[model samples]
Target: MSISHRQTASGRPLRVAPAWVGAATPVAGSPADHHPLPVRDAVWIWSVRRFARLALWALPASAVLYGWFTLGVHVPPGPLPIALLAGWLAAVSLIALAGLLAGSRTRRIALTGLLITLAGATLLLPLAALPEESAAARVALAPGQVHTLVEAACAVSGAGVLLLGWAVFRSKLVNPADGVLLMLAAMTLGAGSYGVKPVPTVGALLLLAAGMGLAWTGGRLLPRA
Candidate 1:
């Protein structure tokens, strides 16, 4: 006798889905194909990638060293300060160049001019300080003159910081928080240069913060495969 298939009390067929039914279904596409963040320009992003981390770290370290020096702490005098300043300036220059590449034409011009002014001022700093070392120095400038020169350097450098900060913010190349930190650092430093009491300490704190922001931003810009 022929037997019919077994059925449940609900009158449903007692059967399994065929294995071929699953095979016939289309596979879902990979999630990786749709990246949340789109890739930016390789040239501008990667150009600074290798050295950005180093610059980020060194900039903060140098700021700390200089801050201690400014505080008249256990820091040694002479070439140590000069060396730190040189290294700090070099790192800043690299960062500025990266910003310039990613910045608008107006910002590029402003940053470039400020950097040039800073370079010239830095070169003349030692010469400007000579009057303090030797009372009878042949190439001595008046105390007022020396002060003016130093203040000018500080002001110009601060302007460079401001421009770079604005550029980074405007370009949106890094995290928005990073741009805010950069701008704060620049403002603090600029304000401190005006002989404001206790402003230097605030500037030092902001400088450290900006360095951290830079490092974080650099990490975000690293290339992915």
Candidate 2:
């Protein structure tokens, strides 16, 4: 996302608000906090909700990645997937950043765009599963076209996941653990790209494994209320 700062008439910082404040406000106190804190509860609740969405997304994403490796999926002999994924991220981030510029009133619109982007991306999996949709037909590469697609996509996803994480962290939209769920996102990316490097594939699998572990921990720790 683009860096934003308010400027005075003189061009110095105008002092609008810190990166930490956003949609959710701090309620006085909760049973969870021994001492009252403003946004702590809201933050955790938002995180759990976000995590649930991703975990749902991950199931199909995993299947798609697996097909990308062992199935008939192909990679572009050229550099399309990486570019495409990066482009998608850039576009999404731009919209989100624009919302940030508009202030609290426009935040919902910005967030809606982001969610749309994610929803669109998730839909790609089922379509990609089809023989016609596979990258194999698009560009004929060496041997492992599908694998290459996965790896490149993963790298792009890691970049995106990290950025989303930062967005959430700074916005105080969710807890740190929520960001941990995004780790699944990174591996989801890696799985797409894993075929490029065997070791990296292992690492990607490890990341997915770790993500599941963290998700489990999150479920245990998250408040039922």
Candidate 3:
């Protein structure tokens, strides 16, 4: 390294370090300086990942709960059942939200389908909640407008699920088998909507399997904290 000399205010000679030395050290705001990720950004990323994981896990759990309530328990439609159904709906919504993070080719389609499903489920909830002997129940269940509306809601939801399944099949994010299962579930559940016996049970079981597959996919795609 070469040194340089300069005259100071007192007229004494001052020695300066080589140019290479200055170049070797990082300047305060220069391009070569390293900057850490901000705390807020880190926290935001963590929260997002955590939510995605939870949503993936919720898919299977909500399916199982819905199946149990609809098939095994045969619980009467009331406040408790309605509350449980609401919770399941919320979980399903979360699952849909997580689909947005899939980074798949058909993610947009999947999200749209999920949103439609959520809307249909919302419409169905109140009808299902009506007490059996209530005047409102009789009016809704009568072969008329309300009954037709219920059927429409079911069909709409089923169509949405079918679309979601197709998107999943093309996504390549998870095993294609999961998409097939979802399609089957949609079909069975659609049949159940028309008073078909035992079909919805099968659909629910298939949904449970699909959920597990989704959860597995999420675990593989996301990094650990």
Candidate 4:
């Protein structure tokens, strides 16, 4: 159910390893357990959790604000409407990020949460965007539409990379538990490249390669919980 293991990485671009629990350690109500929180480690984890949430919420909130200001005032599928739509998508992505966050925390709880969250996104995104898309659904967007959506969404991903990269490589905010989630996110980006061209021969292969690379890397470096 866990989307990815939480990483102890401080600051790195991609998850350089797999994430897994090393062993079943002690828990409260067990023989020697007494504390409600791991006072020594819990504080740091809490702060990391908060930062992750803020980072995710930022993109969607901005887009939502922009949408309200621009296209919400008029019919969608127009100039500002297009931009707002992209923003809404960014919000959905942030929700996914939140799932990753949960997965990185309590494992069992995260599994059900991630499933429900992604199930909704997978179903809803296509339905919402199909109206303006091309029959092929490639950059079926009109001239400026693709550019607008692509750029904004990519920007959100880019910011996430920068911030999370810093946390994984430089800061110690991420532990090994979260590495896989990050790598998965990176792979998804590569997959979305298909939206740009939808050239199955090239795009599909690229996405596959990227996803495999992420899987391989995650399996290698992170602990297999």
Candidate 5:
């Protein structure tokens, strides 16, 4: 029987496999020879991806709900409205998280903006929960230092949103137009806070567009399976 031998670069003799066996064997360090993810790691990855996708889609739905309830229907500040608004804010937070997960180039900026926005939203929640007729609510809502603080919080939140929009604009994950829409949305929404007529509606529509754009980008992240 005849056998073949190969020499390594280091001058060592290397045994060559038979033609049939070599054809079936995968070459070391080849792409096909890579190890697969462990079950636990695989599951974790899948879960994270699923969460990102859901978060992206939720943004648009939450924006619509918030806008419709707060503006379209003029819902009074009560348990239902508060709950809806809270949900919307939560969804917005998730969208930020999804952006981070999507590996945006400006993830740090996005994260900072998210934290600032959450802080503002937190400060506003207690006031929103209070009954309008209550003395405490009246005091808080009165045109004074408390009202000024509220306005400042709103402005801070708007600034945070603007930062987030800028991050999105610079990120490679989504269309730049979406970021423009988001910035405009933040500005118009801030204007609405100051009693600008008909601007809130436009802001809500812009927000919807931005959210939809993010959702579209997220959908592309999912595996085709």
Candidate 6:
């Protein structure tokens, strides 16, 4: 008997043997048939999840750097600092997505859009790092223009975090207190100082709290299933 095969949407190939072979094939009641995650796909998913979990730690580290900067410790304007901060943004967005996978469709869509917006905001960091009057053509933007662009990026990043916080609150998957802390953190973290001293400092503290809280929450719950 000739055998045929078809691929599932998951890209796993399913054998379609002749009717006479049905008795020999694995039954629907078999454990393998009930949960058919192949070894390769399972490994890939586990690796991604592991990376995401590890990335969440970046939040706390980034918070410390941000705290230092906002508290008047001068970090020289450079690409390294900007890249590190951007990486934290990406990490937080990924963690948020991972946590809310079981949430409502609307929440998922909104979170996805927010992640895209946050990514756009992240791209502005390298531009913000450029000096006002650099010898290189890449740093052509005027200082004022670069400042404005960075501020805009900050605004977008804050908005994305705010929306995500709201969605997390609505989902009620985690502690209500954690959700509230997240909202407060996003609010303070996003504030633009414009030369004001205490405002940004306090925001950084809140951000630190938010980061620690999220890391704790993820550690407690994310490893299951």
The per-model lDDT (C-alpha) reads 0.54, 0.42, 0.64, 0.39, 0.63, 0.56
Q: What digit string (tens of lDDT, one per residue) describes model 6 on residues 149-223?
A: 666667677666676666656655454565566567666766653546776667666656666765666555443
State candidate 4's TM-score. 0.29
Write the residue-wise lDDT of candidate 2 on 154-213 in tens digits.
Answer: 455455444544454344333445445444454554454434545444543543443444
Better of 3 and 5 by lDDT: 3
lDDT of 4 by residue, 76-119 (tens): 45545454454465445445344333434344333443444344
TM-scores for candidates 1 onward, in order: 0.61, 0.35, 0.67, 0.29, 0.69, 0.64
| Best-to-worst ranking by lDDT | 3, 5, 6, 1, 2, 4
| Candidate that scores best on lDDT | 3
Give model 3's TM-score versus the native structure: 0.67
Summing lDDT over every window of 10 consecutive residues in candidate 3, give the lowest-scoring window. 14-23
Task: Give the residue spans of candidate 4 off by over 4 A.
Answer: 1-47, 59-63, 66-71, 74-111, 132-225
User: What is the per-residue lDDT of model 5 for residues 48-149, given as tens digits with 9 covering 90 to 100?
Assistant: 656666677666776677667556464566446645564565445555443543454577788877777777776666555554445255565553456566
Candidate 3, 1-225: lDDT as tens digits: 322233434554433221211123347576554433344444555566556756777777778776776655645664466446635854454464434434566767877787888788777766656543452565545534566666787887787787788887887656788888878887777667686667777878988888788678756654312
The TM-score measured for candidate 1 stands at 0.61
Report clashes for each candidate as comma-separated counts. 0, 9, 0, 34, 0, 0
lDDT of 1 at 87: 46
Ordering by TM-score? 5, 3, 6, 1, 2, 4
Residue 188, candidate 6: C-alpha displacement in angstroms? 2.0
In model 3, the runs with Cα more than 4 Å from the true position are 1-43, 72-83, 86-90, 93-102, 132-143, 223-225
